[model samples]
Target: MESTTTKPDEAATEKPVVTRRLDRVFLELYNVAAFVSRFFKEVLMPPYEGKEIIRQFFEVGYKSLGLISLTGFITGIVFTNQSRPSLAEFGATSWLPSLIAIAIVRALAPLVTALIASGKVGSNIGAELGSMKVTEQIDAMEVSATNPYKFLVVSRVLATTFAIPTLTMYTIFVAMVGAFINVNANEATSFPAFIEQFFGAITYLDVFSSVIKSFVFGFTIGMVGCYKGYHSSKGTEGVGKAANSSVVTSMFLVFIEELLALQIVAALRAV
Candidate 1:
C-alpha cells in the first residue's frame, strides 16, 4: 500500500484522557455508594459477628497508636517552635502556649493524624482487599454463604469511626506535651497555664465540631480504601492503584468535609 495519509479529522480524533478519568470517577463513586449502603443494611441486620468486630477494633485502634503518637509528638514540637518566634516578636508570646495547644486540640492534631493514617490504614486496607479480590477469596466467601461486606467492610467502617477520634485525642495530648517542651525552650510559660488556655478555648462547639468532622473523615477514608480494594481489577497493578487512589481521594474528601462541617457548625450555633 502507498502512504496512508491521515486526514485532519483523523489526526484530531484522539480519545480524551480527561473524559476517561471522569467516567472512571463516576463509576467508582457509584460502586462505593452502593457498597456503603450495603454496609449499613448489613450492620442493622441481626446475627452479628462479635469476634470479627472485636478483632477489627483491636486492629484499627491499638495498631494505630504508635504511629499516631509519634507523629503527634513531632507535630506539637515543630508547630510550637515554628509559631513562637513571630508571636514573640510581636509581644504576643504569652499567648503562644494556649494558642498552640488549642490549635492542636481543635484542628491540627486530628486532621494531620488522619492524613498520616490515611497513608497507613487506607493503603493497607486497599492492598489487603485488593490481594483478596485478586486471589478470589472474597468471591469464595460469597459462595460459602457469608456476607463479606458485613464481616470485612462494615466492621472496618465501624472500627475506624470509633478508633480515629480516640487516636486523635491521644495525639492531641502528646502534641501538647511536645508544645510544652517547645514553650519552655525560649520562654517561661508554665504547663498549668498552658493547660488552662487549652481548656478555655475549647468550647463545646469546638470539641463537638472537631470530633464529628474527624469521625466522618475516618469513615470516608476506611470505606473508600476497602471499596477500592474490594473491586480492584487490574491484578497486581490494581493493588497499587487502589492504595494510591484511596489516600488521595480520602484526603480530598477530608478537606471537603472540613468545609461542610464548618458550615454546619456555624448554622447550628446560629440556631
Candidate 2:
C-alpha cells in the first residue's frame, strides 16, 4: 500500500509560495515607486548635473540616430506596402499618407522607439551601472562625496526623458521620407504632394500626445534600467541578469503605458 498524503511541513511551505511571491511583487512595486519619487525630488533640488546630462544625451540620443532612422525607414516601407494595396482596392489609396501618418504618430513610432531604446539604451545603462556596482565604484564615489546617484541615475534618466521626444520626432520624419519614396515608386505621387498631405494630416493634438507618450516611455526605460542595475547582486551573473531584466521590464512597462495612454487619449478626444 502506498501513502498519498502530503506532509504537514510540505503543505505549509507550498501554501506560502504564492503568498510569498505576491508579497515580493508588492514590495518591488513599492520600491520602484519610491525610486521614481526620489528622482523627481532630487531632479528639482540639485546642483544640476548639466554636463553629465549633456554627455548622456549624446550617448543615448545622437548615438541612436542611425538605428532609429533605419528602423523608421523599414517600417515605413513595410507598412505602406501592406496598407496601400488594401486601400487601393477601396479606391482610397489617396488616403495612404494621412493614414500612415496618423498610425505612425499615434502608436508605431512611440512603441518602436521605446522598444529599441529598451534593448539598446536600457541594457547599456544597466550593464554599465551593474559593473560599477560590482566593482565597488559606486561605493568609492559615495566615499568621495560625489553623489553617484545624481551623477549616474539622474543624468541618464533626464537625458533619456528629453532624448526620446527628439528621437520620436526624427523617427516620424524619416519614416515619412521612406513612405514618400515608396509612394513615388509605386503610385508616382510627387514628393512635394506627399509632404504637403502628410503635414496637413497631422494635428496639434497628435504631436502633443505623441510627445507626452515618449516622455513616459523614456522615463520607464531609464528608471527600470537604473533600478535593476542599482540593486544588482551576485557579481558577473548579476550584471547580465540586471541588463536582461531592464530590457524585459522596460518593454512590459512600455506596453502597459501605451494602453493607458490610448485610453487617456480616447477620453480626451471624446471630451
Candidate 3:
C-alpha cells in the first residue's frame, strides 16, 4: 500500500493574512469617507434639526464638563510637578507659568480633551445609535416619513463637532488654573502675574492651531462614532463592539491629527 500526500488548495490560500487585513483596512477607509461625505451633503441640505442639535449640545457639552474639568486639573498639576525638577536644574524655574501655558494651549489641552471626549461622548453616541439600529427604531423612523439620519446622526455629529472645541478651551483654562496653584505654592507667584505670563507666552498662531486641532479632533470623534454605530450588526453584541470601536478609532485618528497639526504648525513657524 502506498500513502498519498495531499496538497493544500491554492484558491483557499490565494490571499495571505496581511493582504486580507490590508483589504479590510482600505474598505473601512472607503466606508468612512463615504459616510463623511454623506454627512456633509445632508448637513448642507437640511431642514436643520435645531431642537435636536441643542438637546445634543446639552448632552454632549454640559454633561461632560465635570469630568473634563477634573481631568484637566489633574493633568496640569501632574505635568507641572514633573516639570519643576527639570526647570530647577537649569535655573529656569521662573518659566513654569509660560511653559505650562504653551504646553497646555499648543498640545496638552486639545489632546486630553479629545481623548476624554472619545471615551465618553464617542461611546455614548455609538451605543445609543447602535441600540436604535438593532431595535429597528431607525427603520421605524423611515416608515413614518422621518429622516432618522438627520434627526439622530446629524444632530449628534454637529453636537460633538461644536462641543469639543468649547470643551478644549475650558480645559485649557482649568489646566492653567491648576498649574498656577502649583506655581504659587512653590514660588508664591500671584494669580495676576501667572495669568499675564501665560497669555504672554501664547501667540495668536498657537491659539489658532489649537482651535483648528480641536475642531479636527471633534469631527473625527463624532464621525467615527456615528459610522461605527450606523453600520453595526450582529445584534446587541454589535452595540458593545460599536462603542468600543468608536473610542479606539477616535483616539487613533486624534493622535494622527495631532501629529499632522504639529508638523503643519512647525512648518508655518519656520516660514
* TM-score of every prediction relative to native: 0.88, 0.93, 0.92
Clashing pairs in 3: none
* 1 against 3, candidate with superior lDDT: 3
Candidate 1, run of 10 with poorest lDDT? 6-15
| Residue range with the least summed lDDT across 10 consecutive positions in model 2 | 6-15
Q: What does the lDDT come to for candidate 3?
A: 0.93
Tens digit per residue, CA lDDT, model 2, 1-271:
8888867676556666889789778999899889889899889977899999999999999999999999999988899889998898899998889888998999989888999999999999999999999999999999998989899999999999999989999999888888989989988999888888888898888889999999999989988999999989969999999999999999999999999999999899898
Kindly list the per-residue Cα lDDT of model 3 for residues 1-271, writing each as its tens digit. Answer: 7758656755546899898789888998899888888899999885999999999999999999999999999989999999999999999989999999999999999999999999999999999999999999899999999998888989999999899999999999999989999999998999999999999999999999999889889888988888899999969999999999999989999999999999999999999
lDDT of each: 0.83, 0.92, 0.93
Q: Please say which candidate is ahead in TM-score: 1 or 2.
A: 2
RMSD of each: 5.5, 5.8, 5.6
Question: What C-alpha lDDT, on a 0 to 100 scale, does residue 268 get in candidate 2?
Answer: 91
lDDT of 1 by residue, 1-271 (tens): 8778767656334758797678778987887678889888888897787788788778877998888888999999999888877897889988887688668877897798788778888888888888889989999999999988887888888877777888888888889888888787778777778788767767788777778877887898788888889888868998889888888988888888877877898799899
